[model samples]
Target: MEGHACPHEDILETMRKLLVAAALAGCALSPLTAYADAPGQSPAEKADPAAREISADQIEATVQFLADDLLQGRDTGSEYYDIAAAYVASRYRAMGLTPGVDGKWMQDITFRKASPAESTLAIVQDGKAKELELKTDFITGASFTDQLIDMSAPMVFVGQGIHSPENGIDDYAGLDVKGKVVVVVSGAPKGVPGDVAATLSRGKTKVASDMGAVGMISIRSKSAMESLPFEKLVGYIEGHAEKWVAPDGTVVVDAPNLKFSTYLSPEAAADLVDSSGHDLSALLDAYESEEEDAVRPTGFVIPGEVKVKAVSEWEEVTSANVVAVLPGSDPQLADQYVVMSAHLDHVGNHLWEAGEDEDGEPKDTIYNGALDNAAGVATMLEVARVIAENPTAPRRPILFVALTGEEKGLLGSEYMAKYWVREDGEPVGVVNFDMPVLLYDMDDVVGFGAENSTMGETLAAAGAATGIGVTPDFLPDENLFVRSDHYSFVKEGVPALFLMSGVENGGKEAFTNFLKTDYHGPGDDLSQPLNWESARKFALLNYEIVKLTANADARPMWYEGNYFGDKFDPEGPRAPAPAEAAE
Candidate 1:
């Protein structure tokens, strides 16, 4: 929708031709076939009487409503987020699901917001000092307290400040930067496996934090500095805007205080180091050759200083989570809960940037995050509808949760998992749906974070029931396990499973291409082709699996040696065996 215009005329013509062709062939149309039935018979015939039937119309309606422009982008703490939350809650109410955990449908959370304001960094070199802007020049070192960080402290040059005992490397083994500002090269340690960019981006702050330095200044290499463009800068500003402002008109926290952290022009960093009477190139060469950790504390310390004044404004606002419950048929099992979750938030509207509509006025661009997560939330709503219509309730209570702020570090799930307690004080296992729509037919469904529990076997068997195979992640290094809400449950010692379509048999290539080109971008719209049939199959498969687990004689437990396996111990893998071995 952002780049290519939809060929509405062409699509209409194609549909008309197909209809005419079907009429000429005297083909009898069946809703079941149009929805998701196996070959040779209508879906109604093949479907188990106990299985809840979901229609394609429901999926379409849900997607349309969630992705509608009126909802904006559903960014957390924004007006759009509140609207989306209300929509989800209303859908749950219409489906006849009672409130879960509490009498209310919302679980509130607290968070701290911070931003950089009026930051100045100056280096006194040869008695001449120059100041740098906050973001354009540098960020801050990690510090939880507010203090005037004077540049008069000694400066230690640590090359690629990394200290990983697991990797047998410690960049700061002999350096003492206590009360001193440390300067380090930004990048990953040499020979680190995986994408250097991703690793460095996520690991740099932690690495600096672990070094116990007063403050850190990162020198960006020429190539790295050159890679920063206007688009990336604007995206960063837009995405982080909410994190700097609270919904209420109160500043939760001041900006962080550390030494001046910034990317200096290669020449600027070199000049500063050289002006301090140190051979910058030689120092780098020696550090590179040493292999082990190396630190060169130049006797000449440049007294760097910084002043920061950050102000945050907020407005009082409120949002909610959608909670619904399906009571179990078995009175005893009804108390145990099986939770299905998906976030209902997305990045919201973007202010106009020199753009005008056909009417010759500035136009606002709404993110309309259809695939980023709206589709997943829509699928959850449809699932709730189907399950509510089932002939008999599941053996165990099923809770449907449409969470918020998933983009904001899974905050909604974290709050619910941490605070929402059962009547008996037991935590609930979560099965979260995220990005369930697939670009093409999937022969296998990939399960992420399955190693943490025996739910992997259940998931595999569930897929097998729908004639779909189960596969482990082909790209585990991507860390899909920790990327979704399921990780929150696993962290709390609750067994959880996350599902994705398998990459085997070409699905991998398709999925990879989608991730690279479409993920999190405006291009991720509903108009993009998706295999609805496969989605339906996936929903039904999960329904069966959740139903079986809910009705099980015992609660689901973690497998031996699993990530959360220790929590269910004494009662090991066999405590609650699988309903059946996966084919």
Candidate 2:
């Protein structure tokens, strides 16, 4: 016993000296630092003892600073966003974490922002051309490159335009859409799983492009309209699309084959399909129906040809993703990483003069994304602090990432998922915190993408430890599972979970109200009343999850027969279904 001094004693002694030095220097001590002041605590008691004692004041302070008007919404590729990235780096330095991005605190990615300069669409029927009006009938979009598009092709009707053979439903099955423009109804059938549906819905353009389609025309069903109306879509007609560029200055194009793409209003779509023997209204209704056996159309050749053209303008910009790491105590498992991520960027200022509105009153144009994502970054930082400050480190390294360009269509996260490689190893699992609206005291949390992987069990354990319940998605139609930065990691075969403030104990009302009033708008600022207690609990829950994941014996795996696992990560390890996982 004389020769076997405990390892943690040395760390404790060092911490005590640091605390004394900090006290003498008049520097503020964190909650974990204050907790460590106790004497004679055993090594077992010192390990992650403050995981549940996350400080609400610290979380609020981070949020207040990030969401302040001085930051100017932290828009990606802007000087203000660079300032935010530097702040996050400073926080990582304060926590004593090493830089995760190849000895740098940030990974600066080059991106190309492209918007349509001139776009035109026309419907050709009975050998006659009818030029449709832009911004009224359809709007060209999703083209990330500066290109000239002039294509006149035959039209095909691909019901949902989803090509997921693993899901046993490919809208393109038995269809000859090669070199043709395909008209697609937005939203998947009600029978499809939520996560699958969300991914598939977004993948329509990529599928069309891959299938050699020359052009794409999108129309929304009633259900899709209920979620995202055409009017709301029109607001985004003048695009601000951004895509990461390679080192060679080549812009990334997800749907390259598609020279033209447009989303039609319901009226325009109805008119296009009226003479094709298929009633658009009936098909939309069938797609939205809840009946077990409903009429869902497969692909068909519509009796029409379409002509479209587009010209785009482009500019290049650079943005950074702030990254830090807490090295593992166990050298054997230290190479593998457990990643915790939250987006650091938000939509920029609105189109308006700050000094006056149309009515001669002061206007607020800055989109201060307080609850949209400043809160999420704050929560991630709090978790990082707790984990980094713990006396005992997890067996596996933990990566803390504050990603930029999330507002620009997940460009930052997509870049990281595709290009950011660690010399040690790949990430074992990812926990993404995005837009946890903590407007009220919540009793539960929604774990998106949980059912698809083994992380569900970790989430349950973490929620239980933090005195919160695991709740199902209350607003399923929103397709939130695929909306955030986590989906980018998922696309790269990483098992990930996205946590959202649940719709329980007035949470539904609060979340709904926030979305209606403040989401992506100038209203998401510090003036709103936020429940700091809930923010503390949310941070604690995510920290517990991160700790459990990093310390687990086996890496997180996709459930056997899971659609996402089978489709995206076919070769990764597999686990039993969640119902049988424990056994």
Candidate 3:
């Protein structure tokens, strides 16, 4: 990564060189013309070809505006986020789509910002007391209440605190934690399949809640605690704003009061656990041993009560999903809908001061998320314009949605999927555009969670049509499938696809390198070289796939055997298909 201290002159010079290179490469590629319907054609046949076309200029324009520093990285709950939202809404209105739900394009979501008002911890060994600083020495909180807890409830250390029926392991089996504070290790028991981390994290919270624990505090592993800081830890907490679901197939409340917290400093944690007579090294060894199915808690039960008073204030801020609709020509077919979406939010400015960049210069720049999502949002807008200009609408309604708060954990999309309903109350099929363009060259398009629905085949056909092959995600073990906005829709039983360019054939090094250095840092910027032409091509291909899915007579179905497929009933009552559902 380049130093952030590049002078203004250097910035200007670099941009000039790139622009000249682009110009030399020949800037005027012919606009992809729409294919005309046959003569004496039915209303469907007379549909505009413009619906499938996207312009390079439009893509550049949207990307430029959204990635501009003035928007301050489009951070959720920041003024910059509002700017991005307003811009998207304006463009949608200009494209001639109706406002969503209440004749307004914006959907308001409420968020709570919370932190501990006061916290105190004590270590008692040999009948002696040692006090710890609240933030520096310990971190704790609960989701169940914002009120102060002033009880010295006994603490029981549970190793990994996992209870997986599928694995035939039950860590909580004979233990009762009712009204007690349970201390658990942060990660899964060692030797568990590497892929089990995600499932464990999701399920562990539920188990803790069901166990009736007053509070759950996860001690970070030694390595994790050494590397992370309170700021980043707190930042992650702020980012976990997604909607959760209960096992019974109900949408749990947005921001449910499930008190879960962690500490990032090893030194702080060592102070809390050292007083126990059991050796820390031995305990960790047992926690990490693969042979131990019955990993016992360290048995260092603390008798002193701890109290936590946390106050979270709700800030009512207005944010929007930029929406534009292309209505179908046939009244009956138009009722069904296909929606395309991308997130426009990113991890904005770093709150703490961290000194200067590499050039010995002061550094306080914002974390501009150019490629992380500005690029994706730009792609969606260009596709919208191209499809709108096309001569005819497809058989079903097409909706273009630019979502907000994705970096804050898919909050925007989750809210829409769980709460937004049509006038007659049916949900729409969502096709999400997330992290699509890659700096590396591609051999195929990778579809995350593609097997969940027949949309995978539609994506394959579109890729084939464009000479871009389709491939299932090569790194399913990473669980990339559930890491994006598409998961929210899939959880709601809405068939969706998350697309990405394939890894360069040379090796996996490129993907890892980019993520390590460029993925979320200041290094991600428009000034960096990007293959815009490939991005434009991707937009065009996506338009075609959406068109096909919308126009198909049979709605896309989830593939059997997939977890999501088995969970949702495709034949169940659907919200009234919007006029655009057919196309």
lDDT of 2 by residue, 117-181 (tens): 88888888888888888888887774665467777889999998888776667888899988898
User: Per-residue lDDT of 372-453 in model 3, one digit per residue for the tens?
Assistant: 8987887777767666655566777777778877886687888777765355334446677876654655556777655556
Score residue 65 of candidate 3 by CA lDDT: 67
In model 1, where do residues sit more than 4 Å from their true spots? 1-48, 109-113, 123-130, 133-135, 139-317, 328-336, 354-364, 421-424, 474-477, 504-506, 553-583
lDDT of 1 by residue, 58-145 (tens): 5555666667655667877777777677667766776677876577666554443333333456665445666655444544422223
Give the Å error, residue 525, model 1.
2.5
Cα RMSDs of all predictions?
8.0, 9.2, 7.5
Error of 3 at 43 (Å): 24
Q: Pick by lDDT: which candidate is best?
A: 2
lDDT pick, better of 2 and 3: 2
TM-score versus the correct structure, for each prediction: 0.71, 0.90, 0.78
Q: Which residues of candidate 3, in runs, are more than 4 Å off?
A: 1-52, 123-130, 141-147, 163-169, 188-197, 221-260, 264-316, 329-335, 351-355, 362-364, 472-478, 505-510, 567-583
Worst 10 residues of 1 by lDDT: 22-31
Give the TM-score comparing model 2 with the true structure, all chains together.
Answer: 0.90
Clashes of 2: 0
For each candidate, what is the lDDT? 0.60, 0.82, 0.63
Q: Which candidate is the best by TM-score?
A: 2
Question: Candidate 1 lDDT (Cα, whole model)?
Answer: 0.60
